[model samples]
Target chain A: MSVATADGLTLAGRDRRFGLLLTAPGLLSLLIVITFPLFFTLYTSVHDYTLLTPNYDTFVGTENYQEALDEEYLPGSLWVTTKFVLASIVIEFIIGFAVALSLHATRRFGSIYYLILLAPLLINPVVVGLLWRMLLHSELGIVNYTIGLVGISPVSWLGDADVAFWTVVLTDIWHQVSFMAILLVAGLAALPREPYEAARMDGASTIRCFIHITLPLMRPVIAVAILLRLIFAIKTFDIIFIMTKGGPGTATDLISYYIYRAAFFGLDVGRASAMAAGLLVIILALTAYLYRYMNSLK
Target chain B: MRLFLSVVAALALAVSAAQAQTIRILMETVPDTRYIQELLPQFEAETGIEVEIEAISYIDMHSKLVPQLIAPEGSYDLIVVDFYWVGEFTKAGWLMPLDDLVERDGVDVDVYVPKLMDLVGRVNGVLYMLPFYNYSMALIYRQDLLDDADEQAAFQEAYGMELRVPQTWDEYWKQVEFFTRDTDGDGNRDLYGTVIQGQRGDCISMQWANYLYSQGGLYHDENWNPLLDSPEAIRAMEYYREAVEKYSPAGSEAYCFDEAFNVMAQGRAYSFVTFNILYAGFEDPESSEVAGKVGITPNPGGGLNGGWGWAIPNSSPNKEAAWTFMKWAESAAVAKERAMLGGAPTQAQIFTDSDVVAARPYYPILGEILAGTKDFPVFTYTTEFVEQVGLELNLAATGEKPVAEAMAAAQEKLHALLVKDGKIEE
Candidate 1:
């Protein structure tokens, strides 16, 4: 019995060693790519690092953070970012869920419908911005030309301060609404039909059945989808960079683009890194909350 | 063993030779740089020295160059720096002072235009770069229209002035307003007057400089106190706002230089004031509808004077090879070649080159304009000033804020920035 136990212990130790060997490369890669940059950004936030005088000799702990927080434009950028995220997510969710329902109800050529829906999502964001910039050009664009044919005057899609904000929001939806639709469709497909059938037998209308059955059952998926999209929406930079560039009197200056201007244009990497670290913390807290919420659902 | 040793020796020699002979250059993707790229083979064929170029957009050049500039050894041996960066690059000790090299090489610096040289070549009595090109803004107009008999009669009757090239701001405004009418009978206001390049940052800054400088306004005094609140400054801002709000295209508030030029080129606008670098683009029949009908002159007050200068970075391992390329590129023969290819000329003689003169009738006028151009007051924070204050300028011009309030905000912002950089008294 002693010999058998010793052999078993040796076998278990070998198995553990083999597992470590298999994961070593991936672990090292994660450390190099993710952990190093994260620590460096935090380290940079504490020091007075600037491209103008790229060094860490001056240790200004939390002063950079203070300045980033106290930045005069910070509130404006945050307000703009919040408005953008809320507008984008609310519109995208409504449109995406409606499309998902229609697609779910279809019985034939569903794959063809999905192919058409996924095309815009597959094109790069920069390409989307460029294509739209041309298509929406006020004087020389096909959009205005078409509108002129119908007696509607040309609209300044990216020029007017009031209109440029909604223009950016609409461009984002055109690119990312597909992502929301696809996720909700997957959720809708996985839902069991027994609850719906039972409600129907009770003489419940379709709307009542949906409210009583589909929504309650799909709460977990809905929560996860909205959370994921909310996180993505908060980090928007590409469309603003390409289309408006936070222009028309700072009407579309989202937070991510503002931070970029601070880093490269302001040449204040220390302050910019502090802002970035602050942004990272907000994102991480949201993600942690999402994890807790998902677990709670379980 | 002997054969292996000899092979290793040969490889080492080859590597060292390649390293010594090859030089890398960086330039923004402007037309001049594109022409230089095309003419690089002539340089290599003549000197037997190889060259490499890394090109980037004008907006991204600063961000891309900083990392390499700060490195102990940089990748680029040569760079084309904008005039505004002359102070920033020199103060940072990032550029190699070129006075000694110029003396040693016996290169005649007299060929370069004097005002152009002063704007870009020398800083604090030190020569850091050779002038590459001048981008001083100039007025481009519809000369054919100005010469028409009926238009002149109508202009004299309407404004009691000749419909000729404007020599003052009031004349410019009157012409712009008068010319803003629908020529086609559809009555949709198809043709606008002037184009205002009020796009957020550099576009508005450069275009508005034509107004500001002509009105005798300067960005700051020697002590770094902003002069944006002076009478001249306020008047300049007011005039700019009036022009943009009253006579420009429907969405002129967001037009960049390219779009502004396009309005004139497409025969949609009567005239525009912009950089002379885009002059040749106006002459192209393929892109321009008003190709043969356009004219050129100096801006009424003066226009923004900006330029490119060729310099070697301090981190360069091969200065002599880079200097060789610069000398060849700036030689009279090659400069003429580039100018004929639609590159902005830095040499005085190139502006008068018979071949170039015949090709571009506006060349002589550009030379006069280059002399009177006003430059942005550059320091370490000049780019930041242009960015932030330019935003204020846009705000005022777009009527988002009043001119006085916006100018005050700009002055305060500039003061705070200068104080932070220790450029001025707190």
Candidate 2:
């Protein structure tokens, strides 16, 4: 018995070592690509560096961060980003849930409907932006033209500061809502029908059944969907870049776009790095809150 | 054994002979790219240097070039530097000075138009680039509309002056107002008087500068003090807003050069003030609805001297090969060839060349505009200044803020930026 136990212990230790050996390459790669950039950005945030004049690097600890705090556009852009993320995610979720419910209820031609809904998700975001830009053009677009037939005057969708923000949000939803719908549809399909059936048999209405049985069970899936969309929507750059370019007097200039303008257009690397660090902190805090909420749901 | 060895030696020699010197060029996706691509085969035949080209949209060119330039070794051997970037590029020491190469090769730098050379080639008395193409703003209008006998009579009656191509800002605005009326009496308005490049960031800034400079307003005095909040600057901004609001298309607030030029070329707008390179697009029958009806004039206010030049990056390993390519591309013969192939001519002689003049009748007018074109401030902080001013101008044009308020804000922002850059005292 003692000899057997020693052999088993040796086998278990060897297995653990082999598993670590297999994961070592992936871990090193992640450190090089992700961890290194994160630390470098943190380091750069403290230095007075400009890409144009690289020879003038000097250690100016916290000056960049202090300057960013004073910049009018930084806070404005952060607020814009927060508003856009919350508004887009909520709207996308509601509309996506509705579409998923509709698709799930349909028994005939459901696959065709599902495929059609998935088409927008497959399109490149930049292309979607350009497509929407043409479609929403005040004078030339078919969207305005079609609406004009119903006695609507031409509306400056992208040119008006009042409307440009919502236009961008709507365009984003149009492009990404399909993704949310697909995720929710899969979640709806995987749900155990027993509880819903029992609720229905007990004279519960469709809405009540959904609220008490379906939603409670789908909480984990919804949480995952929301978290994923939040992560992507916070870093939204391509669509805003292609469509409005954060224009109409910075109505839709989200934090990411502001950071890009600072880094690339302004060439103020230190300030841009500081802005990037600020964004990293915001994302980390939101992710932590989301992870806890998701765990609670589970 | 000897025969086999000789065959092997011959193969080695052939391989070495076929290994031609190659250079990579990064440039904007303008008509110049097409011209260069068509001219490359001949250049390769004459000199066995293979050229690889990467052309991107104008908006992306600067961002792409800056990163490559900042890298330890740049990816591009030759880069096309926009006029506004000359100061920044030179200040950063990213460009290789071409004086030695020009002296060694006896390249006649005098052949390029003097104003263009001044605008793009030189910074602080040092030549770091060679002017490749000119994009000076020119007044493009409908010759047919200008020559309309009844319209001219009505215009004279209404404005108490004979209607012709405007030579000043007040007359330009007057003409814009006169031409803004409906021509067809069909209740629906199809044509606008003019189009403004009012897109928020870059276009409006350049468009407004023409008016500002025409009113004798300089961005800075000799001491680099902020002069953007002066009365003349406010008047310029106000005039720009008036033109866009009163005479431009419904969506003119979002119009950039491409949209403004399209409105003119499609015969929906009576006139447009934009870059000279757009002449090719306006003349292309396939793309333009008013191909032969177009006329070109010197921009009423001094035209904006916007163009690009070819520079060898200091990090480029193939400096010699790149220099050779630049010289060949800028040669008078090649310049004329490119001009005939729809490229804007940088060489003064190309404007006078019979074939080029015949192909583009306004070549002389272009030459005149190039001679008198005014450039944006060429300073290290010029990009930041342009961006801030552009944002404010866009706000003013969109009616988000009043012209005076926007100009005041722009002035304050630019002053702070300059102080931070150590260009001015606190």
Candidate 3:
């Protein structure tokens, strides 16, 4: 029996080694392509490098960080990014949750509604931005034309600073709500119906049944959906870029757009990397916090 | 064994030699790419070489060029760059010294329009770009709307001038205001007085630059410090604000070059101040509802010229092909063909050609304006400086802030940026 056990141990060890060897190429690729660049960007953030003068880079150790912290740069961008993130996530969550609930309550043609609702999520953000930009055009845009019929003056959907912000928010919600809906649908489906039935038998109102039975049981799903949408909405770039490029006096310029201008437009890679690093830290912190909170709930 | 090894080395050397001379060319999408596209096959057939071309938009080209240039890896051999980037490109050493190439080819560099050629292509006295299809800003207006000279004069009397093409900033604004009268006499307004790109982007920067330069306000002084918010700059911004608020669409702040173009083409606008390149589109009856009604005149000047250029990258492997293509594209023959094809040509020689000039009767006046043009600041700090100015200018123009305070804040931020970039001492 001892001899057989020793042979089995050797076999298992060899199998593990073989598996590692097979994955070596993928491992190397991931390190080179992903891990290296990420660390390199972190390194660049502490230096002074502009693409136009690549050879002239100097170690500026946290200058970029300090500069970014200035009220003009970081604070305004943070505010814009926060507003965009909170607004998009809240709208997406509420709308998505409502859609999910309706789909669940409905008895027929459910799949068709699901497919139709899921369409926006599948469309590329760039295409969505272009479509909305055209629709929101003040002079020739159909949105303004339609609004004019109601005896309302055309609202500069993409021109006025305030209106442009709301336009971006609505466009974002329109595009991403489907993601939340699909996730919530899965959650709703997986939910145990016993508590819901019990609440209904006790003559609980629809709202009361949802609050006491449906929501309490679906906490894990809601948490996951919120986390997903929050992460996505924070990193939103394409739609804003296509629509306004953070325009009308930087009113709509989010942190992501600010970083893009720094890196690509400003050609200040070091500062851009610094900004990116700052974003990375914030995102990681938020993620950790969420994970801890989720754990605490358990 | 030695002989066999030698043979393998020889074969490897031969293979590497064959791959040594390849060039990549990047440019904006020209309608026919007539100059480069037509001559490329002939070039390859003659030179026993290969060429690859990548076409993108006016904005996309800059994003791609700047990153590649920063690396200086020489990934591309040739580039078709806009005239505005000449200064930025030359200062970065991302372009090869073309003085030798011009000398070797015995080409007279002076023949190219002085303004477009010198804009950014010369950094501390070195050429970096060649002029392709040259252009200057023009005022496109409705001819039929202004055909009655007596009516125009009478309106001008009420407004204060003869209303010939405006020669000054005030005159320009007056023209916009006068033309803006509700022609239909109906309660509902049918047309805007004018349309201009007022959005905070490259268009805003370009348009502002034209006006600012016209007012003789330099973006920076000798030491490269921010000089915007100077008296002249303020005046220019004020003029822009007044024009936009009084005559432009409600959402003028979001208007881009294309949107402004569409506004005039659709006949919603009585006049449009934009790039001369749009002349082709405006003249095409299919594209424009106001084809015969569309008239062109020299861009109203407070006395300044503006234009854009074609440039090659230092990294381009196909430098010869690119130069040859630029030459062929900018050649008199090509320019004439472009002119006859109903597009504007960059060459002065072509502008003088009767056949080319006759095809478009407005060519003479446009040619005169093109002759008087000048390029924007070609410094390395141009992009950043312009961005700051544009943001502040937009804020002021949009009534978000007092123009004076906004300009001051912009100047302060710009000064800091200049110092940080080492363009000026703190």
Candidate 4:
């Protein structure tokens, strides 16, 4: 019995080593690509570093952070980002949920419908922005011309300050709704039909059945969808950069665009890093609150 | 066995020859890129240096090149520098001075237009770049509309001035106001008087600078105190706002260079002020509705001095080879050849070349404008200055803020920036 125990211990130790070996490459890549940059950004946030004048760098603890707080455009950009994220995510969720339900319910021609719905996802975000920029143009755009046929006057979709923000939100929704719909559709397909059928037999209407049965079961999936979309929508840059360019005035200048201008245009790496750190903290707090809510739902 | 040895020897020699040398160039996506591409084969043949060109949009070029320049070693051997970025690039020590190369190559630096040379090639009396192309803004107008007898009579009756190309800002405004009428009697007005580059980026600021400088307003005094809040500057800002809000197209608030040029080219707008490089686009029968009907004149508000130059970055390992290419490209003969190929000419002689003048009727006027062009303030913080001022100008154009308030805010921000940069005392 003592000899057998010694052999078994050796075998278990060897297995543990093999498992670690398998994951070593991934772990090393994460350390180099993710962890290093994160720490470097944090370090930079405390320095007075500008790439144009590298010799001028010196330790300035908390000074950059203080300046970020006092920045004139910070609050406005944050507000714009929040509004963009919420509006795009909410509208995308509703439309995506509806489309997912219909796709799941249809037994015939569902594959073709799914293909058609997923086509926009294949396009890059920058291309989508440029494509929509032309389409929404007041003078030469096909969209305005089409609407003009119905006696509607041309709308300055990307020109007017008041209207440009919503145009950006709508463009984002158009490009991203397919991603949400595809995820939700997979979730809907995985759900067992037993609970939904049981609710139906108990005289529950369709909406009630969905609320009590489908929705409750879909809580985990919905949480994941919402969180992923929130992360992506909050950091939106390319679309705004290519399309409106935070334009007319500062109507569409989201936090990410502002940070980009700070880092690249202003060449103030320290201040941009500080703003990035602030953004990370906000994201962490929001993520923690969301995870807690998701757990409670489960 | 003997034949096999000979073939192997020949292959080895070829590979070694091919690997001898290579130089990479980074440039903006413009007509000059195509002209250079067409001219590069001859240079490669003569010098036996492999050349690779990467051309990207103007904004992307800056973003990509600046980071590379900040690194110890960059990927590009030669880069195209915008006239406005000369101060920034020189301040950062990113560019290598070309005085030695010019002396060694026996380059005639005097061949280039003096004003353009001063604007882009020399910074603080040091030659860091070679002028490659000029984009001095010129007034492009509808010659047919201006020559119309009825329109001229109506304009004289309304504004009490000869309906000719404007010579001053006030006259320009009157022309815009008088010509903003429906030529086709459509209930919906399709024709606009003029177009303005009012987009919230560098377009508005650069366009506004023409008005600002021509009105005797300076961006900064000798002590670096901002003059944007002065009455002359305020009047210029107000005039720019009025041009966008009242005279330009309905959606002119979002018009950049492309949109503004398109409006004029499509005959939907009467005139605009833009870079002379756009003469090709306006003259092309394929892209323009008023191809032969356009006239070029000196921009009313002394056009913004703008151009690009070739500079060797300090990080470049092949600086000598890059300098060879730069000197060769900017030589008078090459400049004239490029001019004939639709590239903007930097040398004065290229403007008088028979083939170039025949190809472009505005070459003479472009030369005159390039000779007298005034540039934006040369300083390390010019980018920041343009960006902050552009934002405020856009706000005023869009009616988000009053002109005075916008200019005041811009002045305050600029003062803070200058003080922070050690350009001025607090």
Candidate 5:
């Protein structure tokens, strides 16, 4: 009886086949565009194929990987990237949290306030870079002029390594906080109001209520936001590049910019692919950890 | 109903019969669409073709073009590449040689300025791209400030010459110091000695290469070995660093071409070194504070050499059309038009055009400069070498490392690269 039933076509099997057919187009598109290119890049990492000399390509297995690990350029750029990502995400999270709390406190004009807070995120990154560059010009820009009025000497926002790095982080935070704030606002809104009300009835202080109730409830959302922002921040190229091009030194040269310089300017495709592979592994590992942590919160 | 629908479909097909060919050209300079505004209509009428001109900032355009060329895809029919990029473009086979087009079309390449033409057109005895516009760096200053200082006689006494316009590096710096003072006595220093680019990128390389070339330095020696750490090259690098530290803006290390231009034009900086392309902006009264007051001279030399020429890409699909456009664009008539529009023309004759000379008195001297301008070595790795040296120079300027040590390090890196590329024997 079991053999006869197995040999016959069943409704559940037909339904599964239909579902697979429906999803094939989407899956194929992903394979062609994303999955194929990703695997190709991984393969290229172990080969020597400078774009200029495509004919002279060869499989120099693991050499490119070893070279990237030992190269001073890669290490210097990685250090800059770590500092940029850590600083940008930490500041954005703090500011975004504060903004979220304030918005939650306000009942009137909440929608309008949110719309205004989200304005920085709406602007294009390159345009933001150009606009901020103009504002920060030492002689002709208004930023320096405003500081001058306060009796502070004009500061070079983009001309010094230390200052330029902070300025880039500041600009990244300015854009990212808006996004994080919106996420935090959702997290705050989703939270049960009864806990705060009960805590109020018990004569618990507002700070105590926040620390005990609000913070714990918002943890998962905060983790997701940080994880997403951290990954995006690590690959920052457009704004920092437009603003400084990793200038004054290699201070703002992130991993993405380094990979670009290696492939395009340095004309070393194999090394760039290897560097990119390094970034991919790190991001995937971190993402996995974050996902697990978020699931644990539930 | 079927017969009526068939008739309607036939009419739609007829309407769509007029073929419209699309052509895209990428350009870095934001030319007023009006210059070619009339020409497009005539071309479209004759050929039934549509033209799309996508103008991008110079840095952005080059960055985009580099990746596209590596793939050798014909995304653009015409592209404007710089003189330095010609080597990389040709050697990589991203560009198509145009000697056949020139011979078949009877193009008078001789009509273009000889040096500009040679720099852009030739690569290993083959014609790659045609030169478009030519530009050279110049010393721009405020004449009224110089006149008021009355330090011409003082300069003559010290240097045994009258300081009409600085002709040497030493005199130029001295003038920057002399004029950079508080004239209003308002406790606030309203003026600076000079402002020049110090950024560790293309702008710094562009400005500093002139000085490097002037000091008898070469990117590659006769043996094709990268000589970025040579004595002459180090001296040139030292000169640029000292100038920035002594006279330029406080955060001069990040200055680019635009910053240097704004400094002199806004009256914050007494003098600046900038490209002749900025003359139009410097001359506009609405845009500049020192419009009529700005004066220009040949960039003071440690010896004498500097400037840029345009080039065509080897990957151009429309070689014939490109060559035709280039020749027409650089012709005497067009050069005169370009001059009147405040563009620097390549021709020597255009400088002497009465209208051009009257509007821009420095046009004549600019011709002399362009005539004498030397080309940076044509190598596939020119950009990388410049970038490395620029980084090292910036490090030295910021006092992060000793100049000799930084130069030596850059030299070692570049040597390894050259040796690896097989441009130089190990």
Candidate 6:
């Protein structure tokens, strides 16, 4: 069944063998890093795996998932997580797109501007949280003191629950808006000049051109950028950990941190794993929905 | 020539293998760990065993250490266990009892403060660790302010009482309201009465535990039923809330130990309830603006007994080596040396050392504090309990939840957990 070619080797079989050999390392690494851990989490989710007594002997199928669902704080954590993710993503996207448009129109030293815009993103999230915590301290921080000097009252940045959630969201936006801006700017730069030229020749307004040409053409890039931010936003941990710690009565209790509390503080690794797996499912579903919607737009 | 080379290479290999057999310790980021780091060279010179330390903050230590302990062959040979966690780890079989090792080695356990030893040395009659240092809580006040004649007169006029160390919760509150005022007449209230550790988790839990105790709140009954919803417990939580909302600094509702200590150390606040180990940090002229003027005493009603201990994990490969390090570190000479370096003195005898006393005048007060100090409740779910209770306290402090509702909710949840753990009936 082999078709022989040069040097007494079958062309199709030899080509296929070489291709497999070339891609083996990549596939193997993918399996090891991603596939194995995913399956392990699923497996652990079904068992009574606790850090206290880590073993697989106890097979409590779906018990962990049921308990996690039944837990009182689970709803609150999910609600907070949804709010934080939405606020961070929506605000970041709007600001990022605006900055990206401004940068695209810039005629000067663009790299200096990029360096300025990327400064917060360049800092580690941990450092960002700490820097903001100090800067926003109600009594001692420069922010409150400066504001106070101008007759504004001190704002409890991380103390009051309503204020705390928004404070965290703003801090996140400050750290992450740059990412979206840079990504959108790249998308804007890569857009075709031909369509815009056509629109200009047609005497279309800039806003009309932007709506008709830019939005339709840049849809994929926007989709990808927003999707990535959505995924990252859902898993946000460092800011909450360093700043609010899911506190002021579970006001900022993101699901990720709640799972962490379950695993570490509660010592219930199985329940945490189930929660993680559920989050993974939710993320996948959201991604699929977004992808379908993007395709529909096209 | 080849034979001669073989003999030399074999000897080198053996020596290198011996040298590689070293012990590692996991510790909390505290001054005692710093003391150990400085003395590592001496320990190595004496025992010919190299040592390594990985220290982290209290918030991260539990999660980081637990994973390692789960491994059959642990990465660390020695670990510093906070007493609250000793019971949990021991029950899980993650730690090895050291009674036989202590007896065989003739280690003098009596050298340590008995209260500390009782707190961390054993779990259900099995000796699991050696005391490292004491962190028994104390109330630190500005001694200079108390002694000022003008301030006394002002205080007398304001409250019709002599200014002295607060002896009751009522006294503490009155002092808080009276002392918290504009210090420099800038219209911004500069001086607070005291500072609070009202941050989300461990900080608030550890701080409020003292208040809860003094006001007759217990974490649970003997039958493991949560008693947090009782009247006394609610009162205690209300008092803590008032301290944050009405009397303390503008942002005292969200503070960790460092923030509280800094407020007191900068002389912006008049008093702070904190670990006894902080006396040195307060007295350090470089760190504290009020150095040599701060005074320590037992909190108005009670203090919390707390500290860490050194233990070898069951999974550690270097058990004997770890024990050797413990013995060396806890030895009379080494302990005294650590005390001299402003380490929290765990050994009873070090408190009486004239030189040590001269260096740390607050040790006697700590000794008195120790007399009535109580350890935070220990049970199968101590860490979780603290976190849950701490969250409630923070919520009540911030006025996010009514104190009674928060306590009731905490009790309800904890009762459910106790039932799940089989500690109580449904």
* Candidate 4 clash pair list: none
| Candidate number with the higher TM-score (2 or 3) | 2
Question: On TM-score, who's better, 2 or 6?
Answer: 6
Tens-digit lDDT track of model 6 for A1-298: 8778777789887988899999999999999999999999999999999877789999999999999999877999999999999999999999999999999999999999999999999999999988998898777788988988899878878878888899999999999999999999999999989998988998999999989998888898899899999999999999999887887678888989999989888888999999999999999999999999889887
Local lDDT at B140 for model 6: 86
| Global CA lDDT computed for model 4 | 0.85
DockQ of 2: 0.58
Ranking, DockQ, top scorer first: 3, 6, 4, 1, 2, 5
True A-B contacts kept by model 1? 0.44
* DockQ-better candidate, 2 vs 6: 6
Give, for candidate 5 chain A, the lowest lDDT window spanning 10 residues. A1-10
Error of 1 at B194 (Å): 0.9
Summarize candidate 5's per-residue lDDT along A46-76 as a digit string, tens digits.
Answer: 8897867764358999999998898766788
TM-score of chain A of 6: 0.95
Task: Give each prediction's root-mean-square deviation over alpha carbons.
Answer: 2.5, 2.8, 3.6, 2.6, 3.5, 2.3
Q: What value does DockQ give for candidate 4?
A: 0.64
The lDDT values for all models are 0.86, 0.84, 0.75, 0.85, 0.75, 0.86
Model 5, total clashes: 3
**Over all chains combined, what TM-score does candidate 3 have?**
0.91
Which candidate gets the maximum DockQ versus the true structure? Answer: 3
Kindly report the docking quality category of candidate 5. Answer: medium
Worst 10 residues of 4 chain A by lDDT: A1-10
Off by over 4 Å in 6: A1-14, A296-298, B1-12, B221-225, B420-423
Across A1-298, the per-residue lDDT of candidate 1 in tens digits comes to 2233455656667777789999999999999999999999999999999877889899999999999888777898889998999999999999999999999999999999999999999998888987887787776778888998998988988788889899999999999998999999999999998888887788899899878887877778878888989998998888887776688788989999888888877788999999999999988998898878877876
Error of 2 at B136 (Å): 0.7
Worst 10 residues of 5 chain B by lDDT: B302-311
DockQ (Cα-based) per candidate? 0.62, 0.58, 0.66, 0.64, 0.57, 0.66
